[model samples]
Target: MINFINKFKGKSSMILRKSKPYRYLICILVFMTTYALLAMGLLPEKYSLEVAQVSPATIYAPRTVVDPYLTKLAEDEAVAAVPEVYNLEASITVAALSGLNQTYASLEEAAIEEDPQEQELLLQAIKENLSEEIEISHVRKFINLTSEQREYIYTNTYEILERNLSQGIKIESIDRAKNQVINELTLLTTDRDIRDLLIDINVPLVRANLLYSAEATERDRRQALNEVTEVKILKDTKIIDQGEVVTELHIRQLEALGLQETSSQDFGYYLGLALLIGIVFIIIGVYLNIYNQSILVDSHKLLLLGIIFCLTLLLSKAFSYFSAYLIPITLAPLLITILFDRNIALLLTIPLAIFSGIIVGNEFTYIILALTSGTVAVFSVRKVNQRSDLTRAGVIIAAANGLTLIALSLLTGSFQGATDFIKNISLDIIMGMVAALLSSILTIGILPFLESAFGVTTSIRLLELANPNNGALKRLLIETPGTYHHSIIVGNLAEAAAEEVGADPILARVGAYYHDIGKVSEPYYFIENQLGNENIHDSMKPLESSKIITNHAKEGVSIASKFGLPPVIIDLIQQHHGTTKIAYFYHKAKEQGEGEINESDFRYPGPKPQTKEAAIIMLADSVEAAVRSLKQPTKDKINDIISTIIEDKIQDGQLDQCDLTLADIKKIKEKFAKVLLGIFHQRIQYPQK
Candidate 1:
């Protein structure tokens, strides 16, 4: 496994270095394509309905979706419950009375005609004109009446029309009012023609009294449905029964939800999905540019984050086939938070949740649950100090996942009955706990592999190296006790000062511990291990001694690699003195009247400190050795020495590469002063008390 990882890592490194310029664009396009494809799978073809077609199979909600048509149907039913309105036409009755009087006058005129056929003809003409205004039967009766009788008939017909038209009547019930007018006229006069005339005139005159209020009815319906405050079809709810013949209503519900599978795919639908994916990719890219530029530019970090994202999404897609709650959504964040910082892990959380939701279905519930749970996972392990802390973090993460699941379930009101509520809640709680545990388990199992593959340093790996039983540290302790003790003091000073500067203290400390491992090869040649009068370096030429000192850094790198120590610690071994000249050896060589002494030959070959932790260790290593040489060092002396050491490093351009600020330098000096004081403080002698 280790060899395979090394080969894979080597290949990846070559490709990344070669393609550095277009790495960001490549990552974005790859992830965007993946997410778009996942969305395409979940999204249905543009919804369409075929009349009288049986559904191929039962269809369920791919995710929680609203049924707008169902909501509208409910609102329409509320509007239909309101009663119909009828409005009476007062003008109809007025016009009818005027026509009746005009008909009576014409009949009176006809009675005087001497020709009997002409008189009948004139009466018939009057009746025909009146028929347009009132009813045919009533006009005919008035036409034959004597002058005095016709007057009563006209007055009676006008009164009955007024009575019927005075009140509101539905358009459908206009005939009932006509019948009422007939009954009324019959009682007033014994003539059959009079009653029939009343029926024709009043019925024709009656208009719709109440009108249907279209606007008011719609407003009331909206108010009613707006108060309903619930989704028609919630998440995990079934849409249709298996083997049941599809109905028109079923197609309507499915079409409203955009879950209906049509015969052909929609171009517009895919276009919308591609556009949305582009937006999300833009969001991720912008965030990385603004807050995590290192990860944005470094191809290795980008690949690691992208790989984790794709892994989580693929798993979420697989688990969605079973149930939403079963997805181990928190795993990526946990792994990232442990291997990287909380900020980067938190940033990745949003995309992880979003892509997981897309792969599962278009469901926000999964996103919500994943984000909340992953936040807990990130924060819980933020300050991990021991191996047990990861497990403890797992338990807390599980509790948080379960609580978030319950809260979201309550808000959506997805429960149908007590049995359903209990069963589902239990399953959700169990699955949520499983997701958190799986995050811990997977992170624990996969962290070492990732660290080795990417050459990434995590606090867990640092803590392991800090142990006395560690291979490289143990070898130093047994082979060269003096170098081991020197390395331990360097580790303490580096860790304290790095903390003050807000750098990685564990990385600083762990790097310091392995920095002097090369001295194990020739322990007595160094003064720290030469506790007796004999000094191997005193008899040697200054040139040879300087060569021995410079060679230790190279030798340390060789030894460190042999022991399988991380690359970060080996960098400290090489960069601790940087390219600074060996001042003691150079002056001694000049005093001996040598032909020439080159400063570069005595300097350790170095790339200098490239990170804040490595830079802190370099300063701390010099300060520890110089402070220990002081004769009963006081707090004031320690402070001056630490400040002078920092100034010299600045003047020599040793601190140029690292990111430590002026403010950070002052804090590192103060920490060095405090730590040195503890080591060199005077212990007062006292008489036996």
Candidate 2:
């Protein structure tokens, strides 16, 4: 029972030592607090004018008076006393009116006479007699006068009679009326009174006579003297009914109230989104760390990820502000994928898009666009090798985003109002390209730090490390030439195998080169650097020898750290040996009957290979060593040895902790076999000479 308690306590202690709950909780708390602080209401209310239906006002203009001053002057008693012009003209008009009437009566009597030629002669005589007094053209024909034309002529003659009377012309009423009728003879062409009168007399003459008429002048003066009307308000302004309860102001107020009520909501929401997004970023960061097999802390990588996320949000916000119809969904995710790694980009893109939607007012259009663009970015740049590849991926993302915007615009019937939606899409494409460029710049700037800090093992970094003059490589050369040479051959073999199976060749090669760095601590003890010197293993016990060999893994880690290798490379250095027993020493201990020798002492301290590249290097290191031990150089032998080494590692469970599956190992084995065969293909089997 005591032993059981002790065991339980020990296990609990170990669990507590490894647990990261406190760190995670702290991260969450800080994020929540930060979000709460930044999400306060920051917008203002909107205002507008209100109006109801009303009738339009009508306008009026008074008729024009030709001679107001003269009429007014004439109205004065002093002015009326002055002598009036043309006093005899009225008398002549009266005699003419009488004579015209007398002629008309004579013509009527002559018309009834039996003789036709005498009647025609008498009518001609009367027309000639009226011609000099009142133009012969004004005389009417007696042959064809319709009733309507006669009535019209009568109305026109009466108007002329009234005008002459009002003007105080001294003429007999009967003669004046007869003369007026005669004056209208030319208008007998039309049957209507108004048209006939207008046809007979000129308008200017009629207007002049009306202007001079005493009655008309009196009426105009009276109208001008009337008072103007005035308007007055009856009541003070007041609010009536607040109909419908809907307006821009009301909506703005509601938004304001919402913001006030949930002051921390936006912050919390966005922060949560940011955290989720950040975690995805970190995961990608972590994976990249692993992928690159980095050995140092990389703040720049984290900063780059943050910048990419921020720029994505900024661009999305700008797009939304500039064109409410544009979708901002895929920009960040697609950009990350195209500019970085597909898997990492995909893992983070979802949250990035969600956060983007929130930043842009949780718009569905933005969500759709983000998702589409992110997917396209990931798929298009799945295996990017160059910066241009990122550009191409960005183009694809932009096109996808544009298509989404257009399609949504069309779907929602918002296309009509978007006069320059196509142009906006072009801008979005440009933005996407810009995003890619920015991402590349960010990646280049951040990769080194991330690789160093996170212990990530990227191809670029591995290539850099693989150079012979690199500090670590150079140190290895000066300290242990044989080990260095061995590492180079192992790196070549591992690189070929990794490349064949689509694993990270640079990472594998670099890892292989650095795998035996621990040998630098005790260069003379290792056979690779002995240069045909006496074997040290002969003098030391098998257990001591195994201890020395296994110590290299530990010593390698220390050296990696001293050189500022990234955590990923350090992990590879540590995990490459796993906890596998040093076989020779374990066998020697058994042969010597050392009672229960601790197998743990002969094994390497390890968490095992966690990535494909690391696992490949481990397999390559063993295969290269075993292949060099081949007695007869033959393709078959080399191939067999390589296959056995891979099979043995698998059987011994060295690859179990890594992500590499059985299928992956088989592929790896095939690659190793092929490479080994190529390297040791039999030179023309020398004819047994």
Candidate 3:
């Protein structure tokens, strides 16, 4: 088994390097496509029905929406609960007081008449002008009293009317208010006639003082209506049972959601959904631009991301057609974590979860399931070693999904009877486990295709390539033992240096193991694989010798590619020697040739090391070869050779294209010296027994 040593250092193939505008355009297209899919998927299936029509199928509310008709009913009930409001008419009281004062003046004037007959006639006329409650006898007796007494009666009556009438009195309370006025007048005087006259006068004035105020009444009703909450039709709630007669209420409910045949689509609903989806896309784009600019600028990665998103969405929606719990929500995170880093995978899981939840009829249950399952899958595959590790991750995801379902069931109280509860719980656990397992299975199955399509070297691929039993490594061991031994030592040295500099140690180590794989093709032609005291170069021309040595880098790339090694490993094999010249052959040619010898002919064809790991392998390979050629490589000699080899590469401009800093190169030198000291350390000779 291969030892998996480091975090993944896969490089996605750059299909196209996009300019700024094209990058933005690609993002916009992805966002628009995703939004369009979500919008179309979320729309509920419409039904054609009328009042009294039998429903063909049982319909559940696609999304949680406010039932406009039901909400109006609730508002109406709330308004009914509020009492009617009325206002007191101050003008009525004023009119009553003025009428009383005029009547008192008329009675006083009639009392001033000389003839008793004339005064009686005047009292009769005054009686006719009074309210029906006031009899002619009561008026005549009131005129018989002295003017002072009449004025006193007037003053007490005026006070009684003013006080009682000012307070609001609806039509229902008018009788009680009149009785209150009668009691007050009865308490005013001992004389029956005077009491009778005051009772009749003030009681009549106490007409209904309260008036119905439409504005005030309507204001109170509307306030009560405002306080009533909207009656929402929750998601998954059954709108109509199969074969049940459709009522006006059902029709209205369907109309509110635009599910009715005759109902027009609500543009506001689509607009709002579009805006929300657009915002999420903008946030993700901003995050990528700020943090993952490499992916942002590369159209291939962007296209890959878009394809993954669409595939996950398509599957989620398709699976949701059966049961929401069966949707493989973890697929996105698993694929993303393999293709990219975990941070991006983790961040993007949120939107995928939410969108899947929406696709499955807007259930929060699926949303929670997706989020938890995806998160667990990401953490589980953080350091996968082989393909089987993905299956193990599947089991881990399954366990997490099962536990999450149980917790959700407990929170939602979805279980019913004891028997039903156990059955439902078991089904939930099984479905969640299946979905999670499906995510892993799909990830494992799709990874190879994505790897090939995108030219990405994932951690799983690296671990497989690193195995000693692999075909390429095995061929090197069997055919070119010396080269294989040299490769192993170079691997150890490069791995240590890569670790010290925070480069990908696994990439460097594995690359070193296969750097000289081309030697297997013509094993004895190279010095490492030649027999003792046998040199093929002894008989060969210097120019031909230089060609063989330099051609190995190219040959190694072809071999690695033929073995299906990742492009990263192929690059390492090709760039390990860079363009450094075969100094011995080049100098020999200079000495032997009668004409000028070109330096370019002696150098290896190379694009140079483009990454930190490739650079470390290049340096380690040179250091190992030079140190091995020395006789009695003491610690001082090894250290000097390591420094000289690295310094020569630097001076030759071989390290200029890579991103290694001076400090990093210093650390690499120290690390190489320390590791080489151990490899070439002096050994004590055991005495022969």
Per-residue lDDT of model 3, residues 27-46, tens digit only: 78777777776787556678
Q: How far is candidate 3 from the true structure (C-alpha RMSD, Å)?
A: 7.6
The number of the candidate with the highest TM-score is: 3
Tens digits of lDDT, candidate 1, 1-689: 98689679768776785576668566875667565547757665443445566555667765565677676666667656654433345565567656656655675677567787887788667556445645544554555667677667667766776666666556677778767766777776676666555554445555555456667666666676677544477765676676566676677667655666652334555676677767877787898789878877777677777777777777787787888778888888887887767887887788778777777675788889888987888899988767678788889989998888888878999887888788879888898898788778877887889888777878888899898898888988988888788888989999998888888888899999998888887778787788898878788889999999888888898888778888788888888888877888888888997887788888888878888888888898889888988988888889998999889999989889889899999899888888889988988989897
Ranking by TM-score: 3, 1, 2
Query: Each candidate's TM vs. the true structure?
Result: 0.72, 0.52, 0.77
Q: After superposition on all CA atoms, how large is the RMSD of candidate 2? A: 22.1
- Candidate lDDT scores, in order, read 0.77, 0.59, 0.85
Candidate 2: stretches off by over 4 Å: 1-351, 361-366, 384-392, 395-432, 446-460, 495-506, 533-544, 580-615, 643-666, 684-689
lDDT accuracy of residue 469 in candidate 2? 88
User: Where does candidate 3 stray beyond 4 Å?
Assistant: 1-45, 52-63, 80-155, 169-222, 234-246, 266-279, 416-420, 520-525, 534-547, 581-603
Cα miss at 24, model 1 (Å)?
5.1
